[model samples]
Target: MAAPILKWKRLTNATGPSPRPRHGHRAVAIKDLMIIFGGGNEGIVDELHVYNTATNQWFIPALKGENPPGCAAYGFVCDGLSKILMFGGMIEYGKYSNELFELNATRWEWKKLKPKPPRNGSPPCPRLGHSFTLAGNKVFLFGGLANESDDPKNNIPKYLNDLYTLEMKVSTNTYAWETPLVGGDLPPPRESHTAVAYCDKNGSNYRLIVYGGMSGCRLGDLWVLDIGAMLWTKPTVFGIPPLPRSLHSSTIIGNKMYVFGGWVPLVMDDVKVAAHEKEWKCTNTLGCLNLDTMKWEHLTMEMVEDSMPRARAGHCAVATHTRLYIWSGRDGYRKAWNNQVCFKDLWFLETEKPVAPSRVQLVRASTNTLEVCWGAVPTAEAYILQLQKYDMPLTPAKTPTGNPPLSPMKATGVFRPAVVG
Candidate 1:
């Protein structure tokens, strides 16, 4: 139903120079813009590229303030509103850094944070491949690989399981570091694990869910940190946990944590090959964990698998109320003599809310402001207003986009909430 050229839409005029294929980059969403920073394709990259998710336009801004060092595999977290906090990362091919920086997305400014040292316990050591997670204004820094030797070429990685918090005073821009005394079954020291913040329906039990990472080798374990009780508990999960993986991307949408694409060993179902015939490789599999029940399930997209991004690792993914966006990572298998592939493409997967709203109504209160209402569902306890402004494809009007091009008005700006009641 569509022209071949239309099916192969490209960003030929992405404004500024296009980014080179890369891996290990960090991406964050600010409204409709995707801000991409430091990753390694050719050494470490420090340049910033912003892509308009709605318009297919790219703008590489010469930011106003000093940027973080050219780095990759660092601890990066966005505080939901505007502030982006980055912690330790690989400054160079084996050189690790422990400095922290904050980027004010509103002003496109950067400020290196000098945390006030804690009265007890040492601050986190230099690390890379760690988790920097945000719950409200406090940023949590967890396990990563720390180096003990100065020799970059011969340095041995020491796995870390330490936890620290950087409390941000948004108004004054001052920060304090704290080492919380945690109890219960502690997670083993590992790096490149996936961790996400979770909060229950009653707004109780803020927990951190940690999954598979590399210790001395790849591991498949799940651990949770109860922030309120300062306790760790390994919840009994249902179904098969994913094959041991690391360097994956995970995000919370509603009450589920969706994880996709990581360094996984060969799988019979994913590759359709015999067990012995398959080797370790990056995978494109998608899975999620229900925070309420602690269950894991592999998922497939509504669209065909061919349309999805290929197997990848070290990519970055972020979610809005109803969509997941993926960008830039290494692909291919891990072998001694094999050459891996890095990509600079961006992709998005649309997902319906677990509980969709019914009898939705909207009124234009003003030219820019709109009022919305919908029938609540019994299972839904939280709601987020997802605003989508349908835009014309950047191609010509006569372009065959598989449907009647903007000849008729299909522009809809409706609110889609993930958790609705």
Candidate 2:
């Protein structure tokens, strides 16, 4: 089922001095390559890693000059074109930078940017662990906690629900930015959520759906921004909302969005013996929702013996046209992580189209009898077959020379057809 590791399967240890181990670094695939920038593990790390998908190799094109320093949980969006933009991220000492950086593909360099001023209402403050989604040529950012203040301990944590957009304007050798404030009711402030872009109505209205994150407390609420109208709307439906979660992974498949495991709120015990007796509830459910119909459904394994992935949070999920890929993150109870086991396993989700019906033919045994034969339908939800019989008139002598009188018949039923292993 597999082959031994080859020269290409193994990669050389990273070049240049290794930076401090970091977490919450954001990655985006651009032109068949994955670019990963800073996250918060040590301080803000400025080193960037470029992974080549085709070769399974890691390449660090020697940095020519200054790059974005170590930051955590910043907004990283790769517009379909070929640019990866990085926004605010938290540094050591709990300081967040409002600086912006754009990684150029052709030159293989990073360019720092000073964002344009806001047009109307107060602009989004510099924050980390926010959500970013690119629609058309504009990138949208929403919801994260900003600088901490001590006016009052109870209300000092400012969780923002405001939305901001970075619009890229292309002109005759002149390129500028536009920051548009989103309007209408918005969801509560959230961080560490996933936001994905999907086109609606061919390419007219685009939808950016966000799910799972932490505000003052953890949340599992769903909110969407209509990219074309620049409005926010909440989805209302039946079934339990995904268990209150944060650091979960979500990706889109067609019009449906699938979310995997994440950490939920849990009580921690101060003593050892008491912790063992405590019953901890960590959700292991996988769920999805249809954006158009506002219908939600949870996924269950098809076979009883099928092995499922281990529960994890802070993992990342990315959807191709057909399959969804998941990467590593931490697992275990909220406060007590048994061990840090970052996963690198890849799984495939096979979705196939409905098979077409086979042809059917009718045989005539005599003038008054008929027999039909057809191959068994693989997934025969229902079947239809037609037959025609000849009818004789009372005055047979008149000699009806036309084709047999048509008598249509349909066979509709469920029969378990034979299946091949």
Q: Write the per-residue lDDT of candidate 1 for residues 1-421, one digit (tens) a residue.
A: 4311101112334555567777877887777677888887657879888777666688887677768898888987886678788888999766899898989888889988798877697778888999988864577888999888899887788999988988966688688899988999789999999888988787777898888887755667899988989899888899767777888988787888878888876654653343233466788777878778888865544445556677889898877545677877897666321234787677766544346765456644565676777776533448877777665576645556566454222223355666632
Candidate 2 lDDT at 24 equals 64
Residue 360's lDDT within candidate 1 is 52
Q: How much is the lDDT of residue 250 in candidate 1? A: 87
TM-score of each: 0.77, 0.67
Best by lDDT: 1
Clashing pairs in 1: 376-421, 377-421
Angstrom error at residue 113, model 1:
1.7
Q: Can you write out model 2's per-residue Cα lDDT over 1-421, one digit (the tens) per residue?
A: 3322111011234343333333466677664455667654324466686655434456777665347787767888887456778888666444666677877766777778766656565556677778877788778777776766533233345666667777665654222345565777878877777788888767778888888687655676787788778788886856656666777767776777777777665643334422232333344456777777877764444433234555667555554333444444555453432234444433334322224345555444455565656675432335544333435465534328765534332232221222221
**What lDDT score goes with residue 137 in model 2?**
74
Candidate 1 local lDDT, residue 201: 82
Q: Model 2: runs farther than 4 Å from truth?
A: 1-22, 40-44, 53-55, 121-123, 150-156, 172-183, 238-240, 266-285, 302-308, 332-421
- Residue 362 CA error for candidate 2 (Å)? 36
**Lowest-scoring 10 consecutive residues by lDDT in candidate 2?**
3-12
